[model samples]
Target: MFPYFCLLIVTSFCAITEPFYKKQKSIKCILLSCFIVLVLFSGLRYDVGMDYLSYKTWFLSGRGFSEQGFILLTRIFRSLGPTIGFNFFVFIIAAVTLYGAYRFIYKYSSAPLLSLFIFFCFGQYFISTLNLIRQELVIYVFLGCLLPLIIERHFIKYTLCIATCSYFFHYTALILIGIYFLDRHFSAIIKLSGIALITISSPIIIYLIENSDYAVYLKLDIFVAKVTVLQYYLLALSVIIALLYFKCFQGKPMTKKDILFENINYINILFGIMIIMFSNTPIIQVISRLSYYTMPIYIILIPNFISRLSLRSNRLIFRYAFILLYTLIFLVAITTNGKLQHYVPYHSIIF
Candidate 1:
């Protein structure tokens, strides 16, 4: 974890300094290449999260074929050797995700440094923390590509095509389709109102899931479980931060593209809140994974916002605030069984 932190510090420093260098292109290439290699290496030896074990079993059993196709691919590699296969899959998916992230940031924002900073600050540095699951990671890669296209035209057909491809990896990707529409049409007030209503009704929703026919349809089998209160609190806090961010940035000189990016983050916050509030419901749990689809949006937006600070005094204040927020979230995540071992000393290097 400390190594990962060091890498982040270096990446952040490069992003800050390279823009002023005569050989900016070369420096950017080296830093970006290093970042990519780090992600691949981290995934290579790390244990594929236990969540993937189910996918592996399903693939080997020839059950859930549609949902387990990526796992099937990994299983074939596993036949060669479990470690070899797992790492290979991890390397490929992580590489694709990193490329997608780069493109997404480059296309959406003018400031490369801001984009890189956002990438490091948000969960980009923690990509290897979760067990390597091809589907989720692949969905993110596809979304990263699909997002730029959607932003260019806001076309429904294009959005559907991307959503379909993402859903091939995880049905939860379908939720992003709804989010795209919400990002286009929903206002901040409506979002806040919806969140408030949901919060107020959470108890009833919880009760209903616990003792209603909907539970059967939701498949409240052994597969479903309740989330702890701490999880709920953290999710609620995320929503609060998102709303505050929206309020802070609203009516600023931000472009539609920027607004769209921030809206995606807001959507993630809302999705996380819904997941916690309805954690007992398997359907919602499955749907809530869709929030991961927009994780990159945070990496794109927050850092861009940070880079806009001109005054040294303002930069210092914003930097500290950013660090504080990231620390709080990182601590919360680590406390909740999240480990960072996979991401440190990223060992895979293409060179």
Candidate 2:
């Protein structure tokens, strides 16, 4: 708790004061320093994170894992000598994850430090890197690579990228290809209709899965659903904020670059609506995983949305309001989320 709190304070200060620095060099240096700290913090953990023990055990035992990429990666590391292979594997994965995150922030975020802060504090994404290594790797790849392709309307490239990533990492990443259609180039009717189709078909999909031979493999458990209250709050807030932004800033002249954030915000709203619709259903897990593909965009969406404001007072109010809200969420996650408790009393190999 102490270590996590320290990181929160330090990163929060960096994020808040980052705008004061005018030079890109200064900003880059700050980002690099913070990035290094995050990588080390994530990479060097010892007996921390929910899957730490399992990952280490699997690596040492030479057991095959579900993801082919994880299997090949472990094999490559195992050849390096038993003393360092497993730990180094963890370190390399951490580096890749943070590198993807940093690239995404550098490319898209209006406030990179604020984005970094959210990467750390928002729903414990930083901590999640230690647990869902393969999934997070795929997620950041989507953020850094596939998302830009979606914005650029490069359907072929986006499809190829998702295919390659899904083959290597988490297969769930294959679902990301659907996001390309939700781009702003498409008509509002098409976008809403697509979302509506998915929403309406969810029940049929769930029923078929439940009745199919795959049901045993999927292990769908209504009693053990993992969707959290904080997640619900975040998704609901995102929809409310996007709606308010839409209402307040309607018809404002949007720069071409603003379109990117607008599209992301729009997708976030659409997904948020879908998740809320499934809030009571047994398939919330399925809906929630699908929604998470776009949820990380909230870090970029909120800051950039604030920048679009016409009034300085409104921007300031919204900025602090978001900071306050996200801070409370971080606090709640650390104190309450049982899985997150595994991250505390922060251990490191070097220590």
Every candidate's lDDT: 0.57, 0.74
TM-scores of the candidates in the order shown: 0.70, 0.85
Off by over 4 Å in 1: 1-9, 12-27, 46-48, 51-87, 109-125, 128-132, 154-157, 183-189, 213-254, 272-288, 324-351
Tens digits of per-residue lDDT, candidate 1, 1-351, equal 555566556656655554455664775685567557556544553443454445445544546556554445656766766545555655666666667666665655545554565455544234433453545455555555766555666567766765655544665556556555533646658878977887788778767776976667556466575775544544664565565566677766655565566576666666666776766567565544555566555555555555666785785566556555665554455444444333333333243
Q: Estimate the TM-score for candidate 2.
A: 0.85
What's the distance in Å from true for residue 127, model 2?
Answer: 2.0
Clashing pairs in 1: 41-348, 49-131
Q: Could you tell me which 10 consecutive residues in candidate 1 have the lowest summed lDDT?
A: 340-349
Give the runs in model 2 whose Cα sits over 4 Å from its true position: 152-156, 191-223, 244-266, 280-282, 338-341
Candidate 2 weakest ten by summed lDDT: 217-226
The prediction achieving the highest lDDT against the true structure is 2
